[model samples]
Target: MKIENAVIITNKTRLESLIERFNTKAQAKFYIEHSGGNFSDYEQEHFVFKTSLSAVVEKLSVHFKCKVIDRSYLPNYIFTEKDLPVVLGQDGLVANTAKYVNGLPIFAINPDDSRYDGILLPHNINNFEDQITRIVHDRFVYDDITMAKATLNDGQTLLAFNDFFIGPASHISARYNIKIGNENENQSSSGIIVSTGAGSTGWLSSVCNQVSRMSETETEIDMDWDEDQLFFVVREPFESKHSKANIVSGYIDDAHPLIVESFMPQKGVIFSDGIEKDYLNFNSGAIVKIGLADSKAHIIV
Candidate 1:
């Protein structure tokens, strides 16, 4: 592979070491994404580290004949849809991968082994300098994994590489009406969780227990009800007689409708890919459509 311009991204703490190493071996341009506190918070505790990182970037730019840009410049510079190879810090790997970038292989360097889990990383920062040449020049395999797409009542659509959860934001239980295709299913649970294949190992496993019970009686179940498509699990619903949470598991068949309604006072929150996206009101008949996402994450092995 021919790499003319190389962008090196790193956290604030590891910027100096990475810059020094890059300057000694290669002459490619470098860029850093400092992992300081959010830029908006002026009184954040990590201001000192942010300032120190800025100073390091300036010094390295003059020494290595490269330009140093902040994390804010990432959208404008790093993700330009070009076919260039991008080396990212561990944090950058997770953040960017969630955004769904096509055609570019993002190589992540794990800075600390004990601090974080480097499940998606190709190499550790300790030995990355020595193996950098081999990785950039060789052929690597990446897995194309699908994501889940959800459309809210407001016509806003979002994609999740993991799972989509709809539940109460507080201690109160959430009540919602569920419909499969044109048939309105009985409402009896707290909330519902919908997950894709990649998310099956996460919360889906626990939720599957509730739905799996139904499969025992029916031998000739629909193939779409399998683990690959969508899994629906109900949470604890409000009951006047009994104050306990109950969960039920089921899958949405092909062309079948799946919908939920909230019956509690508290607001319902929808989490996409484990991150909170929007707050849903129960007053109106808000419909949330869930399905498979178009893009996939290319995981380099």
Candidate 2:
């Protein structure tokens, strides 16, 4: 599509390398999200370097022959909904930032793939020049992946790109009162996971013991959940004092009345899109609903 104007958003270390590689044509900016006392690795201590991100922005502006704007200038650029520019960030920041910016397509760059999962990332920064050129020149295609929606008991609704999980916050077992349309399932188990087609490969696979493929059709609203049907996996039922770990698998019609009971008292949390959204209380007739959302995520291949 011939990107005459673009913005470069990245973490500190990768910014230097990205600027040295990509030749900017028109307008480009570098944004650095402040990381304070946060360690990249769990074993290492958190430390901030002496060089600020602004230095990298200035250097990149000169090197790439583009205008380098700071994070403060983002609001000015984001004047209208259509003014949403292509953003580049690490895999971790892509989905969340895209959601915040009202569903902008984030081109995730995998700086180091060995340490973490880079499944969503397009390519490593080593091929930054070629990949960016291809993206700008309309040489690649992007897909809009469907997202899942959940409504809590308190009438709070949220959207998730990956999966929505309802489970115990602590290590103890928990219960969930679940209802899918008219079919009711009272699950007394560790938790429940309502996953999207995109999240079929992750935790849902481990729980259901089956790999899930991405949905080909846009907004496939099939409620039929068999071995082949998509939108499944309600697992790790709560074990009562007299009961065992009851793990059930079935379609929407086969999902029976679910009620989870745990001896250990703990708060159960609901996660939207792999992020902790809210907490649910074990009360009389507390209902948790799971379904597909109308929104979707645009993905570039």
Candidate 3:
């Protein structure tokens, strides 16, 4: 079998959280126990992740050239075409990493299945060897996942495996000019959420849930995981003399993209997949166009 290089992406465990709060494991244990925080649960969770990681590393090393990396470094880290990413986390982490990975085949591995309902994670510690063997031999199936992209007038672009949040950085109201298809409106609200198929069941679903609750009639929309189109929902559009709320929610595709012009003078921001730290400025004079990206996530199945 031709060996392909593999990148194992793992995140920090709860032990890091314990260390962060108390500065040491002993102090963390003391703090947790004294506060009735169940230190044993933390210990068990940490042990399980460490064991799974050891197994993954040991197995992959025998098959291909592999390296382990932390989740925090995924943004700055570069991925090659021949590199297969083995993401060891929950469904959200898959989505987070997918945005930067381009079209590389991602082997999603759930470190602890009992703790997570990983919709995107198909492999675990026990069954990962078989999956890795197949991947090395070029025998596997993958799901094509379409993602959303947002381009600013300044030439900066943001990609979302799940969705994009465009709004104010602070608690104040956000002002923007929204264009959906041919209709355009000046909207004043909280923000706008543009979603892809991967995000339809996530942030997009919450918006739909709220809509269902507010309306008297029942509403249902079929959202398939590999769907080509995208969805956008404007949050809390206020009706006034200058701002309109008619074109608040709609669909976007190759033919029609969601466009927005920022009216905010300061603190306006645009970020993808709920990662707030990585974002672009969307203050006044910024025009952002959100649509489907040419890149897709190839998840090993």
Error of 1 at 149 (Å): 0.8
Per-residue CA lDDT of model 3 for 172-245, tens digit only, reads 88999999777998989999998888788888788888888999556555566678889888898999999989
Off by over 4 Å in 1: 1-78, 83-96, 100-104, 126-138, 181-183, 186-188, 206-228, 237-247, 252-257, 261-266, 277-283
Pairs that collide in candidate 1 are 175-262, 175-263, 176-261, 177-261, 180-257, 181-256, 181-257, 190-236, 210-249, 211-249
Distance from true position, residue 235, model 1, in Å? 1.9
lDDT of 1 by residue, 1-301 (tens): 3444444454433434444556731221222224443333322323444543354334334323334334434435544333333333444344445444453555555545445566656655455444445544655656555566666677766665556777676666666666656555445455677765656666666654555676654222222212335666666555554333333555553455356555555576776655553334443356677665555655544
Give me the overall lDDT of model 1: 0.51
Indicate the residue-level lDDT of 184 in model 1.
58
Candidate 3 at residue 145, lDDT?
A: 90
lDDT of 1 at 276: 52
The better candidate by TM-score, 1 or 2, is: 1
lDDT of 2 at 153: 58
Per-candidate TM equals 0.58, 0.57, 0.96
Question: Considering every candidate listed, which one attains the maximal lDDT?
Answer: 3
Per-model lDDT: 0.51, 0.47, 0.87
Between candidates 1 and 3, the one scoring higher on TM-score is 3
* CA error at residue 284 for candidate 2, angstroms: 6.0
